[model samples]
Target chain A: MSQFLDFIPKIPVADSVEDAMDLLTDTFAGFFDVIKKSGKFSMEFVTDFLVMIPPVLFILIIAAIAFFATKRKFGLAIFSIVGLLFIYNQGLWEELMNTITLVLFSSVIAVIIGIPLGILMSKSKVAETIIQPLLDFMQTMPGFVYLIPAVAFFGIGVVPGVFASIIFALPPVVRFTNLGIRQVPKELVEAADSYGSTGWQKLYKVELPIARPTIMAGVNQTVLLSLSMVVIASMIGAPGLGRNVLSALQQAKVGNGFVAGISLVILAIIVDRLTQSFNKKRQ
Target chain B: MEKIKIENVSKIFGRHINQALKLVEQNKSKTEILKQTGATIGVYNANFTVNEGEIFVIMGLSGSGKSTLVRLLNRLIEPTSGNIYIDGENISKMNKKQLINVRREKMSMVFQNFGLFPHRTVLANTEFGLEIRGISKEERRLKAEKALNNAGLLPYKDQLPGQLSGGMQQRVGLARALANDPDILLMDEAFSALDPLIRKDMQDELLDLQQKVRKTIIFITHDLNEALRIGDRIALMKDGEIIQIGTGEEILTNPANDYVRTFLEDVDRSKVLTVENAMIRPISLNIDIDGPKVALQRMREEEVSVLLAVNKLREFKGYITADDALEASKKGENSVINYVRTDMPIVPPEMYIQDVLGIISDSKTPLAVVQEEKLVGVLIRGVVIEALSSSDENEGVTENVSIS
Candidate 1:
């Protein structure tokens, strides 16, 4: 029975799937190139500013935002400054700033793209059905699998890293935004309609404001996911502590990997707390 | 002028509205239409006119289309095949822009659930309709504040809807509708969400506001008492069609059909029927000419144990029992006034039967139905009993029929 099962013909899906995908890719060749060029420009512009800004000013800016956000300003500021200093003192300041640039750009682009898509999904069931499964696949696919296509499209640079990070991080924002709007009470919608509000007026004044907290949560998740993709992103020549961690793994250097990993953890904590407080303030 | 007029409006919920409407035109049953076209009949063949400043109630139990009928007036639920004229404009043919304009300027609704925006403060919520219309912020604030004050919610203006009790929240809903200063108010079970006590308070509040604003109102309710208490005219719905439309008194005294009478089976007749409704013209001898002999003769002729006495002005004097009149006649009393018993029950014409039930029960002689200090009618115990009992029997028959 086992030999008979083995003798059964396979679908040969993988071999043909690649051919079909390549044809599909050829069809959208212009669209992909446009995205690649735009991604390159944004990546350079973002990296230039991050690299140009004096490390002290950068630290101060992040620390100042942290100070205002948290009531424990002294503690948050000290933690932030010390963590940043640890990276700077380790001679990884430029690398750290590059990672910051990558994360900032990736998160911003993801949010920009995800929100309207999310809103579109909320507004129409057909869009939601078509987009939702694509999102699920994007989220569930191995992170390493994305690097192959990302590098193929934008070709092994900060742009490809950011493009990959955007794809990886976008789903949460879209999902939550759709959920937030859908969860809004139907009676409130009726009330808005009853008062003679136009569709746009209802969306902006009634639905969006009520859905703010949930959307903010989505944004937070997108940002965190963007940050988490940094290490995997470094394999494609993306800079930062992630690159150091990658190098440490390659050369078996424990101290370099430990410091880089610790710095990433610190950065994650700072971003998480800061976004949370910001979201709380909005509500 | 009629503020709102509906001309055979109907709403059938489905994609095959045209087919469903054709079936409806053929006088097909809702179930048959549903079976044929998968169209759930929401409202069917309704026609009514609400006069200016009238409270026109649409009443039915759940799924009976009261909500749909009210929504149809404001074009919230557009009619499938009929014309709704709001001050002479056919709203069914109106474009979306024109409909919005109509809703903004002419009609505003109060929902059963309050539908107050939870994130907005009471003042902001009240300002919502005006905000939608792009009214100047200062003007809207003034109008919204004025409405809040009228609803007695000014003190809670800055609080969010979630912070208020259900009654208070519904008042915010009321204030929101009122702030628009629209010509018509569509209240879809506006007070039904409240506790009974609060519902009564809100009903009274609405009545008071109606008096003040005098806007045409279309109110929806399942509660008959509420309909009777507030509706200038009520349209009772059954199976998505308006079965009867009449004033409260008309519906009570002369129900349009056995269905309406059955529907009114639980209504307390004593609460609804007035002394004027049940009272009969009194046969009273004028004290100016009627001696005891005459009073006695009048009592015998009327086939009664007692006779009512009145003066030349028709002012109610009292009542003289047949035995007392006879005794006075034997003694040859000059007037029936000496034998007159002043202890009988006397009620005003407008007093509800329930209010006089105690007095009627205590009196041996017929109660005097007086209006402006004049003897208008007499309410005998037997007559009041008959009026109450016959209606009760009718209700009893309806109850058993419905149950079976």
Candidate 2:
């Protein structure tokens, strides 16, 4: 049986994929350049802006946002202040800022692209059928696989890292948005239509507002997923707390790795709580 | 004037619409069309005209296409093939812009589930139509407030729909449609979601509102009693076809088919019947012209124990019993007025038999069904009971009894 199986023709797999990637990179070289430059500039701006705020003031600001977002609930606010202070004390503040920038860029890009696509999918069966499988592929494919295209398009840097993070984080928001819009009661849509609401009016006034909480949940997921990609993104020259963890791993310094890893956890917890509070405010 | 005229309108849902519609034209049954072409005939060849300021109710059981017919009138569900005319303008052939304009300007709909936007406050929901039409903020706000006030929901204008009860939410839905001040109001089971008591209140309020606004209303309901209570005329549908269209009294007296008869059998007849339907011509003596002997003779001739006494102008005076008339004659009274008793129950001819049941049962004298000040008819206890219980076989008995 082994001999018979071995007699089958060998498939041309690796060379074809490599050649295809090379061709795609060549075809969209200028477009990729523009995206890479814009991406790097925005990422750097956000990082610099975050770094400019003193650690104490930034912690106070986050605590204030948490305080108001939770309708003056003291627990989340105190946690934000303390958790952010602990990260600052760990001496990973600059790396935390870089990670914040990466997550911020990726999540924003994902939401801006995801929502309309989700709405499109909700509105049209053809678009839903075409995009649904694409979303499944994007979500189920290993996060590392996106880095190949990210590198091919934007090259290794913060830009490719942001690109890969966006791909990894986009599917949830899109899927949730489609689900949310579709979940709106049929009667309400009919009422809107009965009132002579245009397509855009119905979407903006009825579908979007009703779907806000669900869409917000998706956005929270996207932000967290972007944050989770920080460690993986560090492999492509993305500088963040993830890079610190990577360096500690290379040097086999357990204590150093633990500190950086804990800082990432603190940031994750703060971001998650804040987004969740924002989501709950409307609800 | 006919505000809306729908002719040969049909709506078939699902694929192979052409085949389904062809089958529909060939008079195929709904089930057959569905099995053959995989299309459900929602409404088939519905034809009707709604007059301005009339509440024309379309009634049927679930899946009977009453809802689909109403939707077709407003072009919400596009007709497979038909013409819908609103004030002589063909709606089915209108472009998107024209249709939108028609919807915004000429018609608005209230939903069974209230269909209020949960995110918006009551005021905001009420102002939706005006806001969509680009009315100025202050103007739309004023109009919306007036509509809310009319609905008795002005105080709750700032509250979200979720915070309000189902009845209040439906009131907001009504106010929202009213804010647009469209020429036509399409209410698709508007009160079907409310508790029975609240539904009664809504129905009464709608009738009161109709009196003031007088807009053409096309109401849809599964409840025959509601249709009878509020509809100026009702169109009853069955199996996607209209079985009958008539006034409540007309339909009750003359049902078009067995389905309509069965559908209406469960309806509370008291709501549909009036004293006019049960009242009989009174045997009366003119008190100004007739003597006590004449009153006694009239009672004896009519085989009644008493005679209703009326003036020369037919204005109800009272009643005179045979004993009183005999006593009056013995006492040498010239007129029956001296013996006439003014304690007889007076009911209007338009009053429902159900309402007059208590009066007739409690009073010894028959009820005087007066129109204006004139004694037109009398409602006796036996006749009212017979009218209430009259079935098809006994219907002629009641009609002949009333005529005599």
Candidate 3:
């Protein structure tokens, strides 16, 4: 059995795949450049705007948002105020802003692309069969694999970081949207159709409204996943609190890493609570 | 006018449609076709015509294809073979645009489970059909409000469907369909979700609404009692085939097959059989032309102690007993009108037997069935009992005795 196993030769498919990727990169070089420039410009603009805000004012704005989003609940609002003040006191405020910008961009992009694709998947069997496996591959694969292609296309920076983060965070929104729309009762769909609704009318009037809560849940998941991608993205020179954590890890600085990690957790909790409140309000 | 005509329409659900349809043509059994070709026949060669402003009911137990047959009328479930015509236009042959236009302008449907959008308020739900038709916002809103008002649901207009009771939500469903003002209304077990009392109220309300709008309606239900109550004509289905189509009384008297007879076995006959079915030709005297002696002679000839008295125009006057006639004759009364008693219960010919049961049970004399102020027939107690009992031996006897 060992001799038989040894008799099998290794295939040269890896080299062929690398060669094919290179050809694709070369052919779409101009297209990729345009996307890279635009992506970098937008990311920098958002980061600069967030950083320029007076820290106290930014904290107050977030607290107020949490206050209203949670229907005047004091807990999340108080948490937002205290948490941001602690991050500011620890001198990690700028880094927090950078991570916020990165997460914001990645999540928005993922939703823009994912929802329509999800609708397509829900509507057509052929699209579903084709896209389902791709989504599974995207979600189940280790997060690091996306960085190689991201770096290849956009080079090492915040743009490539966002591109990788989007790939990491996109599946939940797509899957949830498809699920939510499909879960609409058959009777409701028939009722809509019986009323002479055109295809688009039926989807907009009946399906999307009923599926709103489930879709919002997916969106919440996507935002959190995007936030989680920040640390991995920092490896590709994306600036954020993730960089601090990354460097602290390299030097084994336990205190620094702990502080950065805690900052991320606070941010994650605030975002989760805010999204959940919005979802509830919609329902 | 014929609003809809369904011709040889069949719906077979499966991959081997051609083989299944061939088996269907060969008159093979539904289960045999399913076994041989892996196809389930939904509706098999259904044929019917619905007149404008009529409630045409299609009824059967679950999985009997009655629902499938109703869906075929609007082409919601496309027929595998044959044609459906609406006002002489072939619905099955129409392209997508024409079909959509027809659905939008010509027909609307109400569903079994209420099918109200949980996210939408009652007003919004009611407005859905009109909105889909591209009506202007103001016009649709007004129309929806009017429909809601008609259904007595206007007070709950701003409430979501989840907040309303099942009957209220179903009222919203009906209002939604009515808001569109379509030519035909397709209702698939629309009241099946309601409680019995609410179901009865809704049925009565629907009949009341029918009197005002007069839309051609194709209603689907499994409840035979409901079909009998509202159906102008009923089509009974079994195993995807329409077994019979007739008025409720005709089907009750002359069932098409054993399946129909069995299907109807549990029906409450008092609810469906009208007084006309139980009424007999009464032995009556014209009080204006006949004297008390003549009335007594006619009572003697008919071998009855009492006689119904009418005027020269055959207008029902009252009943006269032999004693009253004899006393009147001895007292030298010219006509039996003086002796006639006006205490007997009088009913209209169209009144259901159930409605007259109390009146008949309390009255000493046979009830008079009057139509247009004329004594058309008399509903005797024995005839009513025989009709209510639905005895096979006396079925023809009571039915044949009815005045056409």
Candidate 4:
């Protein structure tokens, strides 16, 4: 039976993609180098600046901001304080800060790229039709598959880790922002149109405000997706709890992995809760 | 006199507009055009003039192209072919920037769903049109505040649309349109989504506002009663073409075809029709010259118990009853004024039949349909009965009106 099936073809799809990517990178080496330099500087500034701060002072600052945002609901501010203290007690403060920086920068960059793409998508059916399927593929593809392209494009480092996270996390914001604009009530759009609102005026005055809730939801989703890429990003030399978790797994240190993993969960909850609360407050 | 004139206007909602337009020009049926070119006819060769300061209503069932027609007037939905002239300028020929200018300065629309910005306060919503026109913040606020006050929504100026009731939100919509101070106000089923009671109030409010603003309004509605209640003239559409354009009374008295006749069948005539619709030519007895005996004879000949007495100038003096005239003749009074009773029931020709019901029921003598103190017509009990009965028999009346 094995001999009968021996003639089946095994296509080297991965090898072909790799070869094409290398040639593509070589052809655009100058562009890639510029990106590499920017990526390095940004990644270093964010992670180093965050890591240099004492964990207690950073945690207090966050708690105070949370206190102001959630003035009536002090429980949220208290929760942040307690959550950070727990992570700090576990002596993974630097790792926690590093992870926060990576997640924050990845989210910020994704939002910056995603919002314009979303607006573009909303403006043109051509853009929407082209980008939607690409977004679906980006969202559904395994996180591990993202690192290959990131590593090929930027090589291995925190920059590549950040790039992979951005690639993995971008789709929700784009899709959601497009959806948000599309979902604006036709009557409101008609009202705007009837008033002779110019394109930019219509977007800023009506479409953006109406689409705010949905866009915020998209941003929240992007943040969560970025967090989910943490451990996979660790494989590309992103320093954070993800790195500790990966090393813990390699060394079979289950207790160490649990502590690092819990800290990541803490950060994720903070972001998720803060954004959700902000959305509610806005409403 | 014409605020807006839609001439040979047509819209086909599909990509095959050129072919669809050719088919439209060929006068193909809407369904045939749709099948041939894959374009749904939004409006086809719609021709009508909305007079300045008149509430021109476009009424049809959903998908009857009423909404599409209003949208075309503002170029919100561009027509496939033909011209729309606003104040003698062809809007169809205008470029985008010119059209935008037209929208900004000449026209504003109120949507059915009260298109108030959810994130904006009522004041902000009102200021939207003014802001788009690049008005100063201070001026926009002043105008917005004035408009809001005019709409009777000043109390809710600070409230978000979500915080207000549907009626209040629609008032904000009205205020928004008003803030622009546009000469043309397009209301696309502005009150259709409202509750029955609220809809009535809004209709009345719009009427009141129209009297104040005197803006040329083109209103769209599916409700026949609403059209009849508010329209100075109404255009009834079917299959994207206006089949008839006439006054509400004209539409009812003389529908264009079976479609329009059927459309009017369910409308309550009491509210839609007026006393003039049911009034017959009144017998007038001259007050100065016609003798009491002559007045008595005229009443007997007309087989009516009373006759309206008027001066030589056709000014209504009063009415004289048969018994009063007979008494006057017995007393040898020469003029019918000797018997003319000044305290008889009189109704304006424009008074709704629903309103005349009480006067007719209360008075023994026929109610005189008076316009500016002149006896125009007389509404008898029999005429009221006949008018109402004929409204029930509406289905039989087709191609009845001689209106252009």
For lDDT, the strongest prediction is: 3
Residue A81, candidate 3: Cα error in Å is 0.7
TM-score of candidate 3 chain B vs. the reference: 0.71
Candidate 1: misplaced stretches above 4 Å? A1-64, A70-92, B268-404
**Candidate 2 local distance difference test against the native:** 0.89
Give the CA lDDT, 0 to 100, for residue B399 in model 4.
15
True contacts kept of 1: 0.73
Docking class of 3: medium
Q: What DockQ do the predictions score, one after another? A: 0.55, 0.58, 0.62, 0.63
Q: Judge candidate 1 at residue B119 and give its lDDT.
A: 81
Error of 1 at A222 (Å): 1.3
Better of 1 and 2 by TM-score: 2
Each prediction's whole-model lDDT (CA): 0.86, 0.89, 0.90, 0.86
The i-RMS of every model, in angstroms, reads: 0.8, 0.7, 0.8, 0.6
Local accuracy of candidate 2 as per-residue lDDT tens digits, B1-404: 99999898889889999998888889888889989999988888889999999999999999999888888877778889989999999999999999999999999999999999999999999999988888999999999999999888899999999999999999999999999999999999999999976997798799889989999999999988778778889899987889899987678788898888787678655655678888888998898889988887778789999888889899998898989999999999887776889999899876766678788878987889899999999888888777777655436333432321
Candidate 3 residue-wise lDDT at A191: 89
Candidate that would win on DockQ: 4
Off by over 4 Å in 2: A1-8, B270-387, B391-404
lDDT of 4 at B332: 89
Candidate 2 RMSD to the real structure: 6.5
lDDT of 3 by residue, A34-86 (tens): 99999889889988999999998999999999999988889999999999999
Task: Report the number of clashing residue pairs per model.
Answer: 0, 0, 0, 0
- Between prediction 3 and prediction 4, which has the larger lDDT? 3
Candidate 2's clash total is 0
| DockQ-best of 1 and 4 | 4
